[model samples]
Structures are given as C-alpha cells and as structure tokens.
Target: MRENTAEESARLQSAAKDHLWLHFTQHGTYNDDVDIPMIVRGEGINLFDDRGKKYIDGLGGLFTSQVGHGRTELGQAAAEQAAKLEFMPLWSYAHPAAVQLAERIAGYAPGDLNRVFFTNSGSESVETAWKLAKKYFKLTGKPGKHKVISRSTAYHGTTHGALSITGIAGLKQDFEPLVPSTIQVSNTNAYRAKELTAGAIDVTDEQSLERFGLWAADQIALAIENAGPDTVAAVYLEPVQNAGGCFPPPPGYFQRVREICDQYDVLLVSDEVICAFGRLGEMFGATHFDYQPDIITTAKGITSGYSPLGAVIATDRIMEPFLTPGAMFGHGYTFGGHPVSAAVALKNLDIFEEENLLEHVRSNAQTFRSTLEKLLDLPIVGDVRGEGYFYGIELVKDRATKESFTAEESKTLLHGFISNKLFEEGLYCRADDRGDPVIQLSPPLIAGPADFAEIEQILRNVLSQASAKL
Candidate 1:
C-alpha cells in the first residue's frame, strides 16, 4: 500500500474541512483534535484510507457494493460506455443499454412487474413510485387515493416525497410540513415485540412471534381503514427495514400485508433500495420473502456502486391505465438511465450470474448469522437480527431488561466511542443511532466465513471496549 505524505495528507484534510459537507454527518465536530477520515481506495471487501491503512468494507459502501471492489470488468464496462455515449437523457429518447437493462430487470421482477421507470437514485425512485401511484390511481378512477403508509422508524429517502414517506421523525422534523397525507404504522421489530405490542401478547417463542407478525401486519390494515381505504394509495416497505437497524419481517408479515393491500385496492411497494441485488441472497427481497408486490423500487447495488442508478418496476395492472394513448406519467430524472450506469449494471448483473453470488450468499447466510450472533455474549448486545447478508446488532444498556441508551448516552456511545472505535480497529461498518443504538453490517456479497470472522473480531473488540466504557 502506498502512503500519503504529511503535506499531501494535510492538504486533503484542509480541503475536506473547508468544503466537504458530508451527508447526515456532524461536520462541525471535525477539528484539529478530531480529524476527518478519508478513504482513498477500495479493493475486494476492504478499503484504504489516505494513510494507507486497510479496513474491511463491512457496510458494502452504504449497502451498495455487491460485487466487492476493484473489478476491472465493471470499470471497463463503464469506460467503454462512457467513451461511446457520455451523457443522454431518458426523456422521449431511449438508449440501447437502458432498454437492455430494463428488460433484464423486468424479467427478474416477480409477477407482471414488467414495466420499468428509471431514476437517478433511491430517493428519486421512491418519489417516482409515489407519483406513479397517485397518477395510476387517478387514471384508474381512484383519484381520492393519494396517501401513503409506511412503518415507524423506516427511512425512505431525503427528497420531499421520499422524506415524507420516511418514518423517522427526527429526520423529517426539520423538513416538515412535508408532502402531506403520509401515515406511519408499527415496524416488525420482533426483538422489541413486547413494547410494540403494548404487552398485549407474549413474543418469546416462535408461535408468539408469528402472532406478533400478524399483529404488526394488521396495523397497516388498521391504518388504511382509519385513513379510509379510498385515500390510501400505497404502502411502502423494505423487506428488512434499514433505519433503526435491520428489522426483518416476522413470519407471514409480507403475506399478510399483501392481502391487506389487495383488499383495500392499494399498492404494495417493496422499497429495496438497500435490500436488492443479492444483498438478501436473492435478486429482490420480495422474492426471498415469497410475496409479490405491485411495485419494487430499487437502487444502490444495481451497479455495485460502480455508478448511480435506480428504477421503479411496476406490474401490468398498475401500468394498464398509463398505457392508453396520450396518457403519460410526468416523471423523469435527467440522468435516470445513463448509458454508462446501465452498462455497469448489466455487467454487474453478469458478475452476479457468473460468480453465482446469490447462491453463495444463501449458502453462507446461516454462518454469517451465527458468526455475528457470537457478539450476544457481550452485555451491550441486546439483539442480533436480520436476513441474508444484512444484519444489525442492537446495543442496549441492560440486556436482561432490554433497556436502551438515553439520548445523551446514545450520542456518546454511537458517535463518540463505538463508531470511531470500530473504524480505528479496522472495520468499515455503521454505528448507527438513527432509531436505536445499533451496529449495522452488510458486507459485499463475496464476503464469506473468513470475512465474517474479521468483522466479528473487530466488532468484538470495539464493542467490548464500549461496554467497558458504559
């Protein structure tokens, strides 16, 4: 590994401090005492900082890098496409790469979800989904159905419509009086089942969990009824809820939600921004969960983070009204389906097939779960829950009582100690305090038992020290 010179490092740090405003980051905290971290390179499932120190890419570059890193094939594909056609809009004109990629995605999507609308990012995809839902309902003569339903502590995106659907209050408080008529119901955080269920039912055993799952699913139905079904256009959900940690759906959760949506004449949208592209050991999370959604909004791993791209895949039923002559959905991102991104995604999907990445993740998921479950021996680890390559280890103040950290404690624990400690110990995962104090892990699909061990060891050390601090 090549190291940076003192002057070069200082210059980079200076430039970052002067102008680089990070997303969802507290920029003011970076001072002389607290220097900014600069990741200069990545290869395989590891990242290198400006100082050339290597750390495992445990979060898969914000749950995006599915094929790991440093694959010249993806780079070459991007370069070739860029050389041929650098930029093009998806407005009125269609490109070959986009058409091929769209057809491929449609083929993979379940049911009649064969129509694809490309977007620039996950947020745009979500925005498009909501807009499409409203427009679709209007054209289908359900014009009153303009509202959306999502889960509490869920994160959709940062845009106006996406942020409106996002269930995290703190994230939307500043941006509020947001796009109106969005409602939030309970999430399937089975670990917190007792609290979520208001102690109405036991959640200790498998049978009880099933009951909890049904109850959670019923909340969406109740929300729809309360809002009046005619006013509810769609329900947006992630197969495994991302914010507030990876909350996987309980058994029959999606199935029940699907039934409720169908009964209410509402759309079920699987927001796979972070769960798609083999992250959950399947092409789409809905496939892994065995439910068919009316629409699937995806991005992140589409190009393995080689480029920015997202798409909303809708079923035939939803696309029927829009197919009429002179009827149109007035939504399109300028770089929605860039040729280079589409090319990179096509190549990324090829890598997924050529490498059998999906099967690999499926075969290794249990081992990954067991490896991370080892952390439960630590007093701070309240729960380790998720599916496929996605998991979240929730930190608590007292494991026996399932007590969580106070806001100040969470701030100090997550940001001051845990986040920095894990990175300093050479692991690039998330110590998120968005909903709860939890360490989120979604390594590259290529990561196996060996990488899991490295992640376990690093997290073990950092979390042990964190527990000691507490």
Candidate 2:
C-alpha cells in the first residue's frame, strides 16, 4: 500500500513545515494551510495518512499499539535482535535479549516482583522509579527517606524526575524548579467522589463507594503522616489513573493503597505507564487491581510500540538493597537494556502469548463497557469511566448538573470542537483537555465488538454534534 504522491506529498509537507518539533504540540497549529499530522502507515487497527487517509487507530498508538499496527512479527523481532546483539548496554553488561527480557519481566510480575530495572522511556521508567526510591532509602539506612507521593491529576512522566512525580499542575507549571520532594494525593475520582468528600462521601452509595474507597486510600496515610514517616520515600500511583481520564480503581482502592504503603514504610510505585502491557486487560495494572506494588513503572506496551522499552519491576524486597556486595543503585539508561529493545520486548511478549492478547482483553471488557455506556444519552456525556481496553468519556456541561467545561468552555469543547470533530470523523481518538473534557478511549487490544461499534458510532456522531454546540 504505497504509491500515493502529490510529489511525495509536497515533499513530506515540505520537510514537516521546515523541520518538525512535535511532542505535546501546538506548533502554532501548523502553518501553510495546517498540515503536520502526517502519520504514514500502520495496519491491523488501521492508521495510514500521507494521502492514504484511513484512520481508526483510536489512541492505541499513544496507548502504544498493543498487538495492532502491522506486526511484521515486531519487525522480525527487530531484525533478529539487529542480527544478534545490536548495541547491548545494560551497563556492567548483559544481553541475550537483555537476559531473556529480564527473565520474562520477572515471570509476569506481581508479588516478589523480582527486579528488572531497564528503561528508555515512560519517562525513563519514571526516572528509574524515583531513583530507586531514593536509593532504596539510601541503601537501607533511611537517609532521610527522600520524599514523594502522587495523585491529583496523575500523569507521572515527562522526565525531570518524572516531572516531579507529576500531579499535573499545568504539566508541572512550565517545568518549574522541579525534582524536589514531591507530593499530591486524592485521585480515585469516583466521578469526583462527592467533590472528593467535601460533602463527606456518598457519590451514590455502594456503602458510599466503599467509604469513598477508604477515604481515597487514606490519602496515602495522610501523605505519610504529613511527610514525617521518616520523610517518606515513595507512593506514586496509576494502576488505571492515566491523566484525569481513565480513572478506575475505587472500591477498596488498590486494597487501601496496599495498606497505606504497608503502614507507611512507603514505596508502592506501580505507575504502569498507560496501564502496562495489555492496557488494563491486566498484564499488570497491579494484577488488574488486586494490589501488590513496591515498584512497577513500565513503558507504553513494552515493545508493542515495536522497539523502545522501559521497566522498573522491583520487589524481592525491592531487590534487597541492590544485592549487597559493594551495593549500588546509582541508576543507568544509555538506551537501558537495549539489545534491540530487548529483542522487541521478547518478540512483543511473543505476541502477547501467541495472541491470547490477555484473553482478548478479558473477553471484550464488558463489550467495551456497554459500548462506552452508549454515550450516556449525550448532553456532552458526563462520564463513562474506564477499565479494560481502558476508557474515559467525561465531557460535561450539565449532564444533570455535573456541569464542567469552562476553561474557555474546555478550550471550545476540547480544542476547538471535539478534537477536530474526531479527526474529521474517521476516529483516531483522544480529545483530552488534560483532566476533565475527556474522550480518551484506548483501542487496539485488538479491538472487537466490531471495534466497539465503530467506537460507539464515532462517539455517537461526535457526541451528538457536541451536544448541539452546547
């Protein structure tokens, strides 16, 4: 499927408008008649562009294209590990596809997570799990336990120590003097849990949403007793907290946040960088919420995005003070665990175990959540929440007084009209206004139910024409 050329699409949109600089772009919303997006190719869950057009990859590419996107067997397992050992680097050396993909991601991690470390993204596996939780409390002596905690709008990445454990104060207020002792708290947005309990719980009672998930998991034991649990070491979360959208985890939130980080000896971590490998049909969204963390971090679908990788893993009592003998945690990452991104993450986890694809996202996660809760009979769809095949809808204006939308009306309804009307109606998702003006969807855990009825009929005709323009 090649051969589409308007003089090679005006010389690749004139070398991406004279040199592209995208990431988190605004880029003056592209100039010479707005071009940029580009894309080029992809397969299974679709994609294409550069004149070929197609689309429907509805966010899996950002939520790293699971087993989708033209899987030429993960590019022939990165060209047979770049013809056997292409750039090995897990410093002090190691290879054989990064020691068999870190013993197969420590046998699919959970309890006794069994070390791993590697990194290259997911903000260098959350800046190497906050520098291995401040050097595992300075090699087990608790050298004033290097403070950290996280929640509010969540996110956890964009480097500077995962952007000071990111809680989204406008994406770290223009990266301000960061890398300080972090802290944030209160996230389990059980539909804003009665405005985070100011109305003292009862967001439509299921025993007041399990007492608002045990007061949002006792706010990380009240931020480790107001930062004095030996100056706290770690907390960082996200086994389903992506930004402020896909917020799941409420009822008994992460088992009361693993009993308040095991009664405040802190260190829980589990960032899952977009809910780990299966995007929540559990490979580890902390065992799809059964809880047991210590450190997980991860990267966008391991090698599903074919090459770059990331990890952290931990446990085995946080790698027992870096395996003693002349101990060291003085981090690393010159393409951490490279060897062709650990042989394309051990052949993208052997195509998620020969395409069981985590039981095809656990048997179609409740038909992708009742087909996105049938767009909540739209009035700008106040909430649809999320879980497997990760979701989120939010968008409001008054779905019976849930109100929302005014940061200039959610920047004119999610960036001036529902993200260019759901990519000019072909579907590549996410209209995220960071927190509230949601949309999100995370397609391609080999999306089914006819791709969730063509993503709920293109989000019910662009949210019923964005609820008739409010």
Candidate 3:
C-alpha cells in the first residue's frame, strides 16, 4: 500500500526489529504500529525512505548534518583519508589531519582557548571537558573543586561523567549513583520570568532582555553558593539549551555567567554539542552568544555526521597545568583522533569556509524566525524562541493564560498525535515531551526560506489538528 516492494520492505523490517537497538525509542511500539523509517538515501534537505517517499530533513539528522545529506565531497574525503591512512592514534604522536584540525579549532576559538583534545563524539567531548576541569582544579591545589553545575533540562551527554552533569532526571534515573558531585539549576527562559525581583532575580519588567539575563545569571551564583564555591569546579552551559526547547540565553547571560565563574574561580565550559558548527550562525555558540568560555565541548556538526569527531577546546590558562612536563592526564580514546575522522572534519571545516555556511545561516536566521513565528497566528503556539536556525515552539492550552498540558495530555497530544502526524505528513521534527510538549526544529544550515516555510506549514497543520482534538 505504501508503494514498496513487499520483499524489500520485509527485509528492512526484519533487520530493524532483530538487530537494531534504536536510541530513545520504545521498541514495543513496533509490535504492529508502523514500520521504522528506513531512510536509505538523502539529497540536500530531503530523505528518501526505502519506499522512496521523501521527507524534509527537518531535524538535520538529529542536529548533526549541517551542510545537508548526500554530500559526495564529504564521502570522498573520508574514502581518500581511509585509503591513505585508515587508522592512527593520538596517544604519543598525532596525524596530519588531527594536528591541522586542532590548530584550526584553536584559531577559531575565542580568547585564550588555544588547546584542543579530540574525541570520537560529542559525549566523549563532554567527558573530556569535565575531566579536564576537575584535573585542572586539582592540579591548581583545589582538590575540593570537583563538582559541576549545569542547567535543569539540559543534556550534556550520555556517558557516566557527562550524564552526571546532565540535568534530565529521566535519562539518569535508570543509571543512578552516577559520578557524584553534579548540580542542576534553573535555566534562562525570559518567557517564564516569574518574579524579576525575588531570590536573586531582578529582571522582572516584561520583555526586559538585560534584566532577564542578569536574573538568569544570578541563579549560577546561587548554585555556586549552595554547593559551596570550593566544591564547584566548572559551570557547563549551552549557548542555546535545546532540550528545554532551544532556550537561547537572554542578552548578556553568558557574559554574566562568565563573570560569575571567574569571580568564583570556577571554569566555564560551553557545552555546544548541538549549538556549534553553524547551527547558531557561527563556528561556535559562544561566538554567537558574545562570550568566551574557558573550555568548549563540541561535536555533532564537526564532520556534518559524516564521521565521528569531537573536540574539547581549552584556554591556555587551563592547559598550562597539563603542559607541566610529565603531568599525564591518562585519558585517551582508541578512536579519539582517528585519521579518517580528523580528515573528514578538516574537509567539513573547509566546506564550511568555502560555502560561507556561517554567513548563510546568519543571513537567513531572520527569515527562519519570521517564518516559524507565523505559527503564532495559531492558538496553540505559545512561544517561538531560539537562536539562528535552531528553534522550538512551546505549546499552551490557553494562550491568554499560558497554561501547559499535563503529563497525560502531553503523552496523548505530543507523542500520540503531533509527532506521528508531522512525520506522516513528511516532516521530521521533534515533538518533545521533556520539559514541555514543545515542537523543536533545527533544520540544516543549508536550508533557506523555502525549507522554513515547509517546516512551518507542516507544524501548523499537525499542531492545529492536534490542538483541535485536545
């Protein structure tokens, strides 16, 4: 019925159910509901399922494919690098690609961030940053500085150390008793400013961006105080917190955060796993936010998902302790600086520069924002917020009241209705039920007004239909 040869579809379904352990999926849903989307190919911003139906790349392959899919250049880069040097370790010696990429990343990083530690993916990058922060503090005679502070609803990574820093309770409950010494605090959502003058919040005037920034930043100081400044090693923050639905920091938020971190002698780690590499119209989210973090953990868009490569960039001050002869950190991944992956990353960065992808995203962010904001014409759209192409639409039961859906309502509405309906209608966005039942859109940077229009139209249709049912 879906225009696929029965045998081909059967083969895919069998393989999916038997061998695939999909991430963040309820495998029981496959009992008789729907077959998993077997995307065999992609071109530009469209994915071709095994049945040949094309869906818009609405989420940019999980926020990793910045330059879009089916890029022959990237594929060729990987292949060429593999043929020349299939594998190499960055233990004692480094490869050309890795060395070049490290230098490029260091050059691109702001302030004194002149050191890079490569890893296999964003999760590893997060772990590296955490370990480096803890080690840096310990080396500087602050053994008590071992705790990390992140925001509620923010996801740092899935590894034990990184997961400890992650604030999502759902993701960590199963893996409880994780590495201790992690704290969670309120995130900056100016849209939800409760009391602008109470509990270290002084940004109460409506739509006051600066006040919101100050109020939000004060939360970090509170966290540091509550946790004891001597026990806080670093504050890991994402320029645009994506899990809580792309909550871009209010103006001056990062600057204030940087100040608080420095005033407390705690390192600032910008966890830009999802926000870096052109997702926010800049090489890094810190650049977009106009602040300099002491350490930056990044992955996802480095190779545009062609190959796995993550880098933990550090300020010269932080790396100084590590460079004191024979201070081995004893941290190295087997494939951290894989020659092939590094080569692919280098090529991806080259493509970014050649295409002026950052500039493109910057020029078109306004259009993307305006197009998505059009959804506000609908009754259910409460807030349309984010930076650059990364955005999220927070839904509300009553616009005037800004009442949100209950957990049961969220499951039935977001998971049971809008998410499926949108995908069925040919858009691959996220109908997230995490903090709120928000629809998140982080399309590829290559997208323009047309792509944004398509996303908006699909969201409008599905969200409107779902809201009507609710």
TM-score of 2: 0.39
Residue 469 Cα positional deviation in candidate 1, in Å, after optimal superposition: 1.8
How close is each model in CA RMSD to the real structure?
0.9, 18.3, 2.1
What TM-score do all the candidates reach, one by one?
A: 0.99, 0.39, 0.96
**Candidate 3 lDDT over residue span 1-470, tens digit each:** 25568798888899889999999899888865678878788889988887888899899998999999989999899999899999989889978989999999888888889999999888899999888888888888998999999988898888999999998998899999899999888887666665333534444464576777777788889999999999999999999998868888877788889899989999999998899899999999998878999999999999899888899999889888888987877798999989998888889899999999999999999999999999998889989999898999999898877788998998988888888889899998888977877888888889999888888888888888977886
RMSD of 2: 18.3
Q: Tens digits of per-residue lDDT for model 2 on 92-199?
A: 877787888888888988778978888887888888888788888888898899888888888887878888888888888887999888889888888888777787
Score each candidate by Cα lDDT: 0.93, 0.84, 0.87
Pick by TM-score: 1 or 3, better one: 1
Clashes (backbone N, CA, C under 3 Å), per candidate, total 0, 0, 0
lDDT of 2: 0.84
Worst 10 residues of 2 by lDDT: 201-210
